[model samples]
Target chain A: MVTAKLLGLVFFTCSLEYFSLPHLAHRLFPAWSYLLSAIVLWFIPIPLLIWLPVISVIASSCFFTRRFNGGADSVMFWVGLLLALTYTTADSKTHFSVISVMTIGFVGAFAYFMAGVSKLLSPQWRTGETFQWSLSQTCFSETFPILRQHSRCLSLGILLWQLSFPLALTHRYLAIFYIVSGLVFHIVNARVLGLSRFTLAFSCFYPAILFLSHSGDH
Target chain B: MVIMAIKGLIFNKRTLPLDLLRLFFTSWSFFDRPGDSFRTRLTLYQDATPILEQNWPETVSFKWWQLIFNPAGNDWHYSKQLESCAAILSQKYPSEDFLQSREFKQYLNHILKYVGPKSFDTISVLLEVKKYSANADFQRLVFLTLPTTNKKTFI
Candidate 1:
């Protein structure tokens, strides 16, 4: 359930950061935005995290489609949906939670799969020159400017990301390691590369991933 | 761990989830043109100061998170506009009126009001469109500054 709670917390934090800011005070009523603070209050690892409030936040986000910024926003969308799948039957936590974790894993893998496929199919990507072009951009400061310039590194990155999903589905310990590695990867992307939101948005799934991996050990 | 996973897949032969992921990966690999990753450009100049762009102060005053989830919130619309404008500009060179578009002005105002310094009355934006060509020449399109004197909702 740690994953469940973390999902909610990440969702709440994203909303708080983007939706409930004083900068948006005039647009979204301060009271309404302030009310989101309740989700923050309720983000504890309790058994019965309500779906309604999560739904409200998700709905508000959907209503404001202008806000969809990146893959991180897409991650928030999945977490919001998955939050609804949480069931409260007293039989066992593993039953629904396993399915929930698996579903998140599925979604996560699908995203990476598509990304890898798209890149593989592109001529620029195949030649690794696209990586060079992207890395060579004269835009904001890139985290790995020197590394990015090298097509081999970029190509290897693509291979690892696209190929790693199947590995995560294998053994319990291996899966945990894979997911944790994913977290580290995202952290580097965020901290060094400056793609900040990916850190939280992508890492929210690690709890589920870790739980699922651990479950098979028992 | 490796042995166990291999065993499950081999013995059980019913790794539906994993198989589906495999399928997803295989399917995506087929169509490989240029994948769009929301790589667009937005520039803001307060008299001569660029805000939140590459040419801004070299040290980068804000943190990574600040740059990613910027307070300005300009990426969404700015990106969409760039997409359509790229489509249009690729076919024909943009008109002077379109370059000085109302949408363009509104975006400028947004940057000035939210991100730019209030002290400077004159601000301008130079939008660079990337690769509007089918041949993938990495087409570059940019225009002169759309100047704004004050924040009072340009008339």
Candidate 2:
């Protein structure tokens, strides 16, 4: 229920922002569609109305393919869908919750691991030129000039951290460490790259990570 | 989706379903390397002379609100679209056919609306790709150009 609410809030925030912008919204759906979706999202906390928001999110994601916002949006959809499914199998709640958690956990872990591997494969990242070049291109270059000095070291550290992200699931302490590290990483990314949505979108998975890490205890 | 991803990776073929599924698990290869950044320019011509010239990022404001909302104008999205178009043009078809292709036409329509041009006789798009060197020296190449045409097809 907490995860669903957080996902709802995140969707509400994104949908409101997306639909409110006339230039962005009208290109895809009409104003009424956005309004209706927003209202449904607003009422997601209602026990009976949970499925409506999940459907809305999935539909919105499919409809806005060309204008797809980011991976975070998709993550929300998958997580929301699995969460909605969990509500359906009320008889086997424990088993279903485990399934949902494992699904989300595996997907989330793969994302981080894939990101790290992608960087590892990239020539620029391997040589440590990617960070310096990437940062130089962004608006942060002038303001955070000091980052350029140790760009290589910073890039290597980031690469290793991302590569080892899945190991967080092995131990509760490690999971806590990665969760905090990820939060800080996303916060920095939000500021440096203007990807604020990522911070909230990715943060939604932390709860699942915590659940899985602590699953063995109970 | 996982199966589709593995298939797409091996075959390099993607359907709409696969694309929609990809949003959930994108392999998160965004900016894996210092990738080539693309700048898109749209010029509306009235009578063989330029009337209004618009460039993305130049015309698109980098507002703080964009961090949470209105991310379509974000650098990554725009760059990815142009980069995809360039890749397709380079790999498969001729440039002229590609310009008339539905995929390209739809992209033009969307960008034109985003640019908010009123009216024009001919509108052309110039896609410039920035390539960076090890020494940080960069060069810009006109990667794609849609020759000026009075085609009402775009609008």
| The candidate that achieves the highest TM-score relative to the unseen native structure | 2
For candidate 1, the TM-score of chain A alone versus the native chain A is 0.74
TM-score of chain B of 2: 0.59
Model 1 chain A weakest lDDT span, ten residues long: A22-31
Candidate 1: regions farther than 4 A off: A19-49, A52-60, A88-98, A136-145, A214-218, B1-106, B115-117, B120-122, B130-150, B153-155
TM-score of each: 0.65, 0.78
Model 1 agreement with the true structure over A131-192: per-residue lDDT tens digits: 65544322234446566567666676765677666556556777767777777766554444
lDDT top scorer: 2
Candidate 2 per-residue lDDT over residues A1-218, each given as its tens digit: 55665676577666565554544422233223334544554554444655765555545555443344567667777776677666665456368756876677667777788899999998788777888766644433234667777888888988999999998777789889999999889777766665667777777777787777787445
| Model number with the top DockQ | 2
Measured against the native two-chain assembly using Cα atoms, what DockQ does each of the candidate structures obtain, in the order listed? 0.11, 0.25
For model 2 chain A, the run of ten residues with the poorest summed lDDT: A25-34
What tens-digit string does per-residue lDDT give for candidate 1 at B1-155?
23433433454354444433332233334223434322334455565776434321122234645533443322333334444444354346466765466444444444444444444544444443444244453344444454554444442
